[model samples]
Target: MIRLLLVDDQELFLQGLAMILESQEGLEVVGTALDGEQAIARTRELQPDVVLMDIRMPVLDGVSATAAIRRESPEPPPHVIVLTTIRHDEAVVDALRAGASGFLLKDARPEFLVQSIRAVVEGQQVIAPAETFDLLRAFAPVRPAPDASILAELTERERELFALAARGLSNADIARQLWVAETTVKTHMRAILTKLGVASRVQLIALAYEHRLIEV
Candidate 1:
């Protein structure tokens, strides 16, 4: 089963979402938290595989809570998918910077939410709402770049794949653009992630911007 911990300050919405998710096969709502502080505590106690986190909450906000969970959890920390109303792009970017696996709109369809959770657990990346690439222009934390040297460890094909992925293309999209198998794209992606020392494609995209590899 895919264990989940839902965190939101809104009690009613939280309960409703849990009911919807629990009805789906393969997902179990292991616990719920009303604020970020409780989220951190429940995460340690319940050990859920994924955290559906609310970006804004009392006591502590989701972004700060995400960073704390990543820092404090033992190896292989639970993946975090932050919930957002999305009026503030900066907060979403901050959540990604804090190690959230992705962000999902608070009103996202139930099917999409389930897909995102499965994708993260299976070692895939999730960026949502289709235009998220342009939205995440938050300053990249890095020095001036050759772009080439920062990505020196990558092969030419990997570099190409990296650029495509950094632009928010899904693996299937990248494969179609390159005329390769989707599995081939996934293989290169794994190599790129390993060589770059990043955990997810969201982090890969962050690094690309930080190093000025992709022109803003």
Candidate 2:
């Protein structure tokens, strides 16, 4: 079963969302929190498999709470998907930088949200690639003297896959573009992540932008 924790300041939304998710098979609503501080506390207590976190909240915010959860959690730490109202908000980027698995719009279809939770558990990012690419372009700053030597750690094929993934392409998309199996792309991605020491593609994108490696 995929254990989940929901975090949002709005009580009504939390109740409604939890109802929808709890109805689905293989899912369990383990807890809910009204603020980031509560999120941290509940997460430590429950140790859920996933957390649906709202980016804006009182007493704390999702980004800070995500950082704390990821930093202190045990092995196979919970996957955090940040929820937001704005598509191009910089806080989403910050959340991703702070170790969120990805961002999801609050108005997404229930089925899509449900699929995202499952996909996230399967090591797939739950986000819109094109929009996320645009978001990175807008908020990711370019250094005057960028250092991307860490990219050298990747093998040639891994570097190619990294470039496509940094541009927000999915593993399946990369597989189609590279004329390989999706599982093959997934393998390369795992190797790339381990080589560069990034936890997810979001962090990989952040690292690429930090080093000005990807052309904006």
Candidate 3:
């Protein structure tokens, strides 16, 4: 079962989300927190597989909390997905930079939310398709061009896969597109992450955009 922690200041939202998630098979709501500080504490105590975190909260915000969790947690840290109400908020980028696996709008369908939880746990980044372009565009102006030497390290095939990932394709999608096994796509993705010195696929996307590897 995928263990989960829900963090949000709104009591109703948090409880409702917990109820919905618990109703799904293969998922367990291990705990819930009202803010980032509690989220961090619960993460250490419960060691959940995933955290559904709200971007804005009292005590500490999701981005900083994500950074702390990623930096301080032991091996196999919980994957974090920032929950936000806005579609194109810059905080999503900040949260990703801080090691969040991805972002999801608060209004996402229940089924998509469940699917995203499973997807992230399986090593896929999960930004909503509609928000992908806008999120990338929001980061374009401020990001420095990606390091050319780092970009040069990718093999031709790796570059192709990287471009696909930057375009918001999941590992399964990339595998199907290239007629390769999903494991092969994952292997390439791991190599890409290491070569680019990035922690997540979201960062890879940002780098791709900054370097013009793929059109926005």
Return the top candidate by lDDT: 2
**Best TM-score among the predictions, by candidate number:** 2
What would the per-residue lDDT of candidate 1 be over residues 1-216, giving only the tens digit for each residue? 999999999999999999999999999999999999999999999999999999989999999999999879888889999899874567877888788888888988999989999999987776652445565554445556545676889999999999999888889999999999999999999999889887678887877877777765
Cα lDDT computed for each candidate against the true fold: 0.86, 0.90, 0.86
Candidate 2, residue 156: the lDDT equals 85
Error of 2 at 25 (Å): 1.5
Q: Write one digit per residue (lDDT tens) for candidate 2, span 138-188.
A: 897667777869887778899899889988888888999999999999899
How badly does each model clash, as a count of residue pairs? 0, 0, 0
The CA lDDT at 85 in model 2 is 96
Using lDDT as the yardstick, the better of models 2 and 3 is 2
Worst 10 residues of 3 by lDDT: 140-149
- Model 2 Cα RMSD, 1 decimal: 1.7
lDDT of 2 at 69: 92
Pairs with backbone N, CA or C atoms under 3 Å apart (clashes), candidate 1: none
- Looking at model 2, residue 213 earns an lDDT score of 81
